[model samples]
Target: MTTVELPADAMDPTRDDRKSAKIAAGRVRPEPGAREVGGFGLGREVLRSGQMLQAGVSGDRFSPEDRFCPVFFLDGERHKKARTAIARYFTPKAINTHHRLVMERTTERLLGRLRATGTARLDELSYELAVAVAAEIIGLTGSDQATMAGRIEASLFATRVGSRNKAVRFGVGLVSALHAGRFYLRDVRPAIRARRAERRDDVISHLIDESYPDRAILVECMTYAVAGMVTTREFIVMAAWHLFEDDALRARFVAADAADQTAILEEILRLEPVAAMLHRRAERDVAFTGAVAAAGDVLAINIRAANVDPAAVGACPHALDPDRGTKQKQVGSFLSFGDGSHRCPGAQVAMAESRIFLDGLFAVPGIRLERAPDLTWFDGLGSYELRHAVIACTPAPTAD
Candidate 1:
C-alpha cells in the first residue's frame, strides 16, 4: 500500500469542485483551506442557511400555530427549543443507559427466530427489530410491538395505490388514514396516557410534559415512527445485502471492532441514503458558493448526488472505503442522515442500534442469503425500500 499525503486543509468547501472528481478518472485530490463545509457543500449550504425552512412533510405549508410539528419540520427558535428538549433521549449517555439492552435483546430474539425457522425474510425481521428498539426509546411500550410495527409499516409503506381517479384516491387516502389512526390509538395514546400519569425519560413523555395536545403528540409519534423504524429497517436490509454478497467484505465486517463495523455501515449508508432528497423551502433569498434560492423557492437537496460529489468525498466517490471519511476528518455517513440544524438527532442512536443488530445477525452460523429483495422507489420519503430479502440459517438444535 502506498501512502498519499493530504494537505492540512482541503477542497475549499465553498469553491465548487464542479464534478471535477467525476471527470478526473475516478479520483480527485483535495487541497487544504477553510473547508468547514465537509459533506455535500451545497446541501450543507441550504441546510445551514438560516433562510431555509424545512419543506419536507409540507412543513412550509403549515401555519405558524401548526408549526409545532415534528422537529424535522420546525424552523428557527421553535426548532431549536424542540430539538433541545428532545435532545436528552438521543444523547450518547441516554442511549447507552436506556436503549442498549433493548437493542441487544431484540437482536437476540430476532436472530433466534431466524435460526429456528431456518429461512425468513430479512426485511420482515429487520422491521420487527427496528420497531422494537425504537418503540422502546420513544416510550411506545403500550401495545404489542409486532402489531404496532405492522400498523406503522402499513401506514407508511403500503403500496401507494397510484390512480388518477378521484374516487380511488379517496379510498387510498382513507385506508392510509385508518392505518395511521390504529397506530395512534393502539400505540401513541397509551404511551401518552402512561407518561402523563408518571413522567419518564422518553420522547413521548417529553412531548406530554411540554403540553403537546394529543393530536400533536400523535404527529410526533408518527415522525419518530418513520424516522426511527422505517429508515433503520431499510438500512439493515441494505447492509446485510452488501455483506452477504461479498465474501471478503463480509469477513472484514464480521471480524471488525465496533468502531470499524460502524464505519463500514456508514460507508454503505453514504452510498445508499434512505432519504435521497431532503426538501427545504427558502424563507428568504439565499446564496452560497455557486447556488442561490429565492424566498418561497422549494429546494430539493439531492442527498444521493451530494454523497457522491467528488469534491467533498474525495476520489473514487463510488467505491466503499470505510477509512476515507475518517481520513478526511469527516463523519463516516457524510450527509446520509442530513446536515445542519435539522440534521437527524438520532444519528448516533441509529448507528449504534444498526451496528449492534447487524453484528449479531451476521455472526449466526451458516447464515446465508437465500433470496434478494425487490427494490422499489418510495416517493413518500424520497427513498428506496427493499423487501422479500430471504435469508437462511442453520436451525438451532432441538433440546433433547
Candidate 2:
C-alpha cells in the first residue's frame, strides 16, 4: 500500500491555507492509477460511489461484539432494520414535538447563566446545552446536567487513541471502558429500568421495547450522547465564532427567522464541518475518479475538502455563503453529517440545538468574543476541538 505524507496542518480544518493546498493537489492528480493517496482523498465522486463500506470492521476497535455497535457499522438488511426501528425518534416532527422544548429551555438557562456571569467560556455553555438536550432525549435523567456532561466528556477521550501505540491505546481504551461502565451504572441503568417498567417515547424506552440487552442499551446511549454532545458543542462554538467575527453574517443571522437560521448554520457547517474526515473501507476491488482500490483498503474521505470542492459546491467554495445557490448536479454535495445510509440520525437535533442556542446567545446585547479561540485537532480522528472561546456578555435588560 502506498502512503501519502500530508503536512501536519493539512488535517486541521481551520487552517485553510494548508488544507486548500492539499485539496488542490488532489484536484490536479485525482489519486488514480498506482498513485494512491494513502487513504486520504477529496472529491464528491469518491464519497458517493458504492465501492466503499463503513469502516467498522477495518480494525479491531469496532468488533461486532462491541457494545457500541449501532446501525452505523452494520450493513445491508441489518443496518436497514436498526435504522428503521429508531428512525421515527429523530424525524422533524419528533424533534419539534418532543425535543424542541428541551433544547429551548436548556439554551435559555445556559444563556441566562452566561448573561449573569458577564464573562464565560463559549465551549462550556455549548457543552452544557448539548448535554442537557441529548441526555433528556436518551432518558438519562438520573444525573444532573453538569455531572452527565463531565462523564460524557471523559468517555470521549477514548476516541483519541487512533494513532497511539498499542500499549497506550489499550490503556486508554480500558480507562474509557471503565468510565462508560460507571456512567451506565450511575446514569443510564436507572433510566433503562424505569423504561422497562413503563415505556416512554424516548430513545431508552425505544431500546427496551426493541428488547435490546442492558449492555447494548448502554452502548447506544453512549453513541448518541457523544454524537449529540461533542459534535454539536464544537459546531456551536465554531458557528458562533464565525458569526461573531463577521458582523454582516451575525446581523443577517440575528435578523433572520428560524428557517433562515437553519440555512446559515448549514452553510457554516459546510465550511467548517466538525468531523472533517470520515473513514471507510473497500469491501471489494473498485475504481472511481481514476483511482483503483483492492478489497480491504481503508480510505479517508476528506469531508472538509469535499464540501468545498469547486466542482461540487461551485465558485468560491471556501467562502461562507449561506445563500450559495444549490447545484443539483453535484455528487457529494454537503457532507457535514455524512451521506448515505450511515448518516447521522441526530442531524436535525444538532441543527435545532445550534439555532436555538445561537438565537439566545446573540440576543444578549454586548455579547462579544472576549478573545479568539485556538482550534486544535485530535490526530487519532481528524476531528477539531476549540479552546478558550471566552465571550463577554451583559445581562439582558430585565423586564419591568
The lDDT for every candidate, in the order shown, is 0.77, 0.72
**lDDT tens per residue, model 1, 1-400:** 1212233244233332211122232221121111222348888788888888777554544564574666776789888888888888888898788789888998898899888889899999888888987888789987998888888878873345557789987888888889888988888888888999999878888877777899888877888888999999888898888788767667788999988999988988887778766777778888878876777777777676778878888876766667768886898888888888989988998899888988998889899898988877665565677889899989999889
In candidate 2, where is summed lDDT lowest over 10 consecutive residues?
29-38
Report the error of model 2 at residue 107, Å: 1.2
Give the top-scoring candidate (TM-score).
1
Report the Cα RMSD per candidate: 7.2, 7.4
Q: List model 2 lDDT by residue over 1-400, tens digit each.
A: 1123234334334324122234334333211221223221343444555666676222444664553466567765666678898888788998889889988888778878777778899998888888888888788876777887888778876776564489988888899888898888888988888888888778899888777898888878877887888878888998888888777778888999987898888888877777666666677898876677788786666666677666666665666666653442432227878776777888988898899989988988789898877777644445677878999987666668
Residue pairs whose backbone atoms clash in candidate 2: 32-290
Q: Tell me model 1's lDDT, rounded to 2 decimals.
A: 0.77
Clash count (model 1, backbone only): 5
For residue 88, give model 2's deviation from the true position in Å: 1.1
